[model samples]
Target: MLIGDVARRSGVSARMLRHYESLGLVRPTGRSEAGYREYSSEDIRRIFHIESLRSLGLSLREVGLALDDPGFTPSGLVDDLIRQTRERIAAETELLTRLRRIDAAEPAGWEDVLRTVALLQALGSESAGKRQRAALSSAEEGPVPVEALAEAALSETDPNVAGALRWALARSGDTGLPLLAEGLGSPVAEVRRRAVQSIAEIPGGAATALLRQALTNSDVVVRRSAALALGTRGVANAVPTLIDMIVEGANDVDAADALSALASDPASTDQIATGLVGRLARGDVEASARRRLTQALADIPGTTTSRALADLSNDDDRAVALTATYLLTLRGAQ
Candidate 1:
């Protein structure tokens, strides 16, 4: 076949075929009567092979080595190609994410686009200070997508930066609650903790509802954070977890305070007192935990708490008796 005919049939251009010949990749097996470059069937096949390899991201030099070097094994080269392709894909994916976030901001002009880009880069910066500043400024400037802020809040490890991210997310209202809710289910314990903490900062019925759902989360940290936040929000469902916190000595003081806050509501007063009294009645209630439970009852104003404290005042444990007596004195004074 003539060079033109070979080019037409193989889909390799004439210029490319000549270039391959110059590189000694392929050559015509024989000359035609007109002295035009002629290619045998074998030469045309080699041109097709080179194009096939190039499609796999092989450079011309690598393609030549692959075609000509008998000692070359494809395993290492193929692995390298796989790694390169993965890296390219990862870079493209990150770029796509950035573009999506920027578009979500709905930038009004070139200046807005540039500011959003800068804010995003700063949020991902290695310096905690830069991330903190970015988070603080996010609420003041053109809106950063709530998803971006929520993602940052979940992944942030630095306390200051995490606080700033949470504040920014809170200011965004419950827009990020769904994302944060998903974070509560993350396999990473720290991520689950952060997710609950961030959700606690967001104020609304949606956020409160999410915290209520998190009350049953398997992660202890998530449950505790949710309980504390719910307590402040005047949700009575946090009573059991708060009582458990007191027994376990995990933020027991805060849990007691939450119980007290709940007790302020006349409807919840007896429920809170009953939960505390029930823990006190348990055979497994340790002396210190029993006293803590007694102290927790001091602020609860009801006959149930009064009877429990009165019983505690006569207990054999000196610490429990004295603490209950002191509380009774205060109650009498009130």
Candidate 2:
């Protein structure tokens, strides 16, 4: 077969075949009577082989080494090719993500598109200041796409930057909740915590519902954050986790305050007080936890809290008894 037939049969362009010949990767065995290049079967096979190696992302020189070097080992070169291919794929994927995010922003013009792209690049910047600025400017830069904010929030290590991203997501309303909720399911504990924290800041019944659902998350941090947010929102469902926080001494002061806030509802006051008292009554309750629980009771009013406080006043632990006594005296004066 001549170059034309080879090009037709093997799909390697004639010009590329000549380039391959020029590179010494392939050569025809003989010339036609007209002095045109003619390829024998072996040369045709060699041409196919060159195409095969080229398909593996081999540079022309590497392909030459692969085909000509008697001592060349495939394992190392193949591994290198695999790594390069993976890198290329990752680059393409990142570019696709940027394009999709820009499309989602629905830029009004080229300037809007550029601003969104710049903000996205800044959001991923190594400088925490840039990341924070990008996050703060996202809303002003034409809705910088919630996915970008959620992704940054999930991975952000800088506290100030993370706060700005959370604030941006909150300003986005509930649009980012689904992504943040997905973040909650991430195996990374920090991501899950950030997810719940961001979700908690969003102002909507939807966020409140997600926080309530997150109360059962397997991650203790997620459960705690969700519980605290729900407590502030007056969701009675957080009562159990809030009470547990008080007992475990994990952010117990905030937990106690949340419980106190929930206690203002006449209907939930007794329920909240009872949950606190039950933890206090547990035989396994530690001295410190019992004291914290007793202190928490100071904010809950009504006969249930007053009675629990009276019972706790005589407890064996002197500190617990003192705290309960102090609370009861105040209760009586009211």
Candidate 3:
């Protein structure tokens, strides 16, 4: 068949077919008398194999090497792909676990999250040598029993379950936000806080709005959680509300947390730097708030904070002097 016919059949473009040929990944069996490339049924089969391998996250180079292997088996390739997918899923779950811990305030809950994280680390270490043994053992046993193991794993009340759920929601933020947003209005403060925390980890406009709405929760903890979540999104629109909460709010810890979140976001770092510098110049802000705000600004990268810190170097206030020194340390300027 012609290149166009192969493209139509395989859903791959002719340009990609030529590129694959140039890479030695595919070749035409022969050329017609008219000088057009001719493909065989075997060629189409190889193309489909390449596409499937690519979908499994294998690089073209790796796929080519695997295809060239005399001992390569279909089952072996499927097992490898499944293993790779599981590893990626595990890594994402671990990251989400850490994020949830950071967002959690209660010592007991945070410790539980930490323990799960440690277990995941240990599992990775222990599994490295066992995977090949397990694969070999599975071949002798006739089937891997993956479905049974997955069912058993899912039925357990593991602390890592929350991490896995949070990870899934983060990856599927578009689909998860509605459920999370609804949870924010739940009667339980803990549920509302978790919802806020999960939404904060997801970056999107709807998540931002959900967090903003959460700021109105009657419970102080819920309100603080929402403020922290909004800070993660770092939209300019949330700045005024966060600043108001910090400036007038009685909860010093929550205010400081919100400021830290705002400062960590690169988008809000410049504004945070300017606000902190203005407060320092006026000498009206509380000492603790000023200290936290200055440190937060210095922690974020960019030229804006550097220049702002340079201007503060001459300030007589002890907190300003300390923050300036910290900023200078970041620049390796002593």
Candidate 4:
């Protein structure tokens, strides 16, 4: 076949064929009588081989090595190609994410677009200070997309930066709740904990609903955080988890205060007092937990709580009995 025929049949343009020849990647096995380049069947096959290697992301130089170097092994080269492909894909994905966040910001002009881009870059910066400043400036600079704030809040590791991200999300209201809800399902325990913590700071019935869902999350930290937030919101469902926190001594003081806050509601007072007393009555109640439970009862006012406290005043554990007696005295004086 002549150069034109080879270019037509193989789809490798004549110019590319010449370039391949210059790189020593392919050479015609014959020359026409008229002096034009002519390719034999074997030359056509070699052209196909070069195109195939190039399809696998091999550079012309690598393709030359692959075809000419007897010692050239494809294993290392193939692995390297795979690594490079992955890096390219990661860069593309990051770029796409940035574009999406910028689009979601609905920038009014090039200035808004530039500010949003700068904030996003800072959010991902290696310096914690930059990240925190970005989080703080997000709302001030005209509201970085809520999605960006939610993503930052989920991944932020630095305590101060994380706090700022949470504050930004809270100010954004429940707009970020769905992203945070997805974060609650993350396999990483820390991510789940952060998701619940961020959601807790958002005030709304929607945030409350998400917190209620988080109460049943498989992660204990997530569940604990959700319970504390729910308690502050005056949701009665947190009562059980609050009681559990008291028993296990996990944030027991905060849990107790939450219980006390819940008790301020006339309807929940008896229920709160009863839950605490039931834990105290359990056969497995330890001395410390029982005392914490007794101390927890100090603020609960009701016949149920008073009767329980009076019964606890004569308990066998001296500390428990003293705590109960002290609480009862305070109650009587009231």
Candidate 5:
């Protein structure tokens, strides 16, 4: 076949076919009557091969090596190609995400678009301080999409940056709650904790509801953060987790404070007191845990807590007896 016919038939442009020949990738096996380049069946086949390899993100050099070098092994090259393809896809996906967030911001003009883009770039900056500043400034300029803020809040490791991101998300509104809630289900324990903590900062019935739901999360950290937030919100459902926190001595002081807040509700006072008493009766409750539980009851105003405190005041552990006695004295004075 003539070069023109091969170019037309194989869908390889004439210029590319010529470039392949210049690089010695595919040589014309013969010459036509007009002395033009002629492509034999094998030459045309080679052209098709080069085109096929290029489609997989192979450079022309790699394609040439893949086809001509009998000693070349495809396994290494193929693995490299796979890695390159994944990287390209990840870059494209990140760009798409940035575009979607920019669109969500609803920029009205070029200046708005530029500002939104600058804020997004800053949020993704390698420096935690820059990212934190971006988060703090996000609200002053205007709301970045809550989705962007939620994603940052969930993945951020720097305490200061994460706090700023959570604050920005809270101000952006509960629209980010659904996105943040999804993070609560993440397989990463740190991510789940951050998600629940961020949700806790968001004020609203929806955020409170999410925290109440998170009280039952399998991750202990998630459950504790949710319980603390709910306790402050006066949600009584977090009582069990709050009590567990006291027993475990993980932020037990904060846990005790949350229980006290929950106790302010007349209906939950007995339930909270009774729950505390149940743990105290357990043989498994260590002396330290027992003391923590006893100290937790000081803020409960109900008769159930009073009776439990009275029983604790007579306990064998000297520290427990003293702590309980002091609490009872304070209660009596109140």
Candidate 6:
């Protein structure tokens, strides 16, 4: 068949057929008297094979080697491709596992995920070439197996084990919610606190409800966790709850953190400042609590919080006065 006939049959153009010939990818069996190249059945087969391999992402050079080597085994190439694909899947599985673990009520099993990441890093260090590194990087960026890790975490009763899982899940964000929710009801206050803290990192409507429930929990630690969770979520919906805690709850780091969360937003600052001032006026909260709330309010900029801080700056409590002074300095109101 002529070059045009070969091109038509192979779906390649006549010009490409000549170029393939020049690259020794295909050769004509003979030439017509008119000087046109004539392809044989064998040349046509090679062209088809080249096209198939190219479609599979093989380069021309690799395709040429495969075609030239009579002993070339497609099975070997297929196995390598499968192995690479599996590695990519495994990497993705590992990432998702970490995410699920973070959201799990029980802790996630992050040892395997960490190990896999370490292995990838090591492979990168020992990579034979840039291509291997690129492949490894691509695999690393794939989805993780968070569900599996969450399941593994649920099987363990150890706090350390659970903490590790929580750490891994926290890195991935809200995927660990279901599992974390389970921990919220744990018998142990510490476990509940950890779970609440993990959920707080992931602010959502669902998480907000969970934290709200925790605020009314029997354990102070649990309640504290709820407050901190609300703070981390930074949702204005938590403002009323946090204010209530500040007015009625004992002076503690968690309460301080909750106040900070409330005042973190410019919009919430006024309400929080007003609440703090009210608490001070009523003498319902301790002097220490008042100081913490004053500082938290001062952390917020603008006129409302600033005026609130100025009132507290002359309070009988030295700490409250100092904190208010510090806030005034921060706001350039000194």
Q: What's the true lDDT of residue 321 in model 6?
A: 87
- TM per candidate comes to 0.97, 0.95, 0.40, 0.97, 0.92, 0.46
Q: Which candidate order results from sorting by TM-score in descending order?
A: 4, 1, 2, 5, 6, 3
Mind giving the per-residue lDDT tens digits that candidate 1 earns over 1-334?
A: 8988998899989999889989988889899788988898899889989999999999999999999999999999999999999999999999998998888888899888999889899999999999999999999998677788999999999999999999999998888888898999999999999999999999999999999999999999899999999999999999999999999999999999999998899999999999999999999989889989998998899999888888999999999999999999999899
lDDT of each: 0.92, 0.89, 0.62, 0.92, 0.90, 0.66
TM match of model 2 to true structure: 0.95
- Model 4 C-alpha lDDT per residue in residues 113-132, reported as the tens digit of each score: 99998898898889999999
Off by over 4 Å in 5: none
Return the clash pairs for model 1, or none.
none
Runs of candidate 1 exceeding 4 Å displacement: none
Question: How many angstroms is residue 105 displaced in model 3 relative to the true structure, after the best TM-score fit?
Answer: 34
Residue 143, candidate 4: C-alpha displacement in angstroms: 3.4
* Candidate 6 worst ten-residue window by lDDT: 130-139
Cα RMSD, each candidate: 1.3, 1.5, 22.8, 1.2, 2.1, 17.8
Total residue pair clashes for candidate 1: 0
Task: Point out where model 2 deviates above 4 Å.
Answer: none
**Judged by lDDT relative to the true structure, which candidate is superior, 1 or 6?**
1
Task: Rank candidates by lDDT, best first.
Answer: 1, 4, 5, 2, 6, 3
lDDT of 2 at 99: 95
The sequence of per-residue lDDT tens digits that candidate 6 reaches over residues 153-234 is: 4443445545554555555556667877787778876667667766665655877888888877777767766766677677
Which residue pairs show collisions in model 2?
none
What pairs collide in candidate 3? none
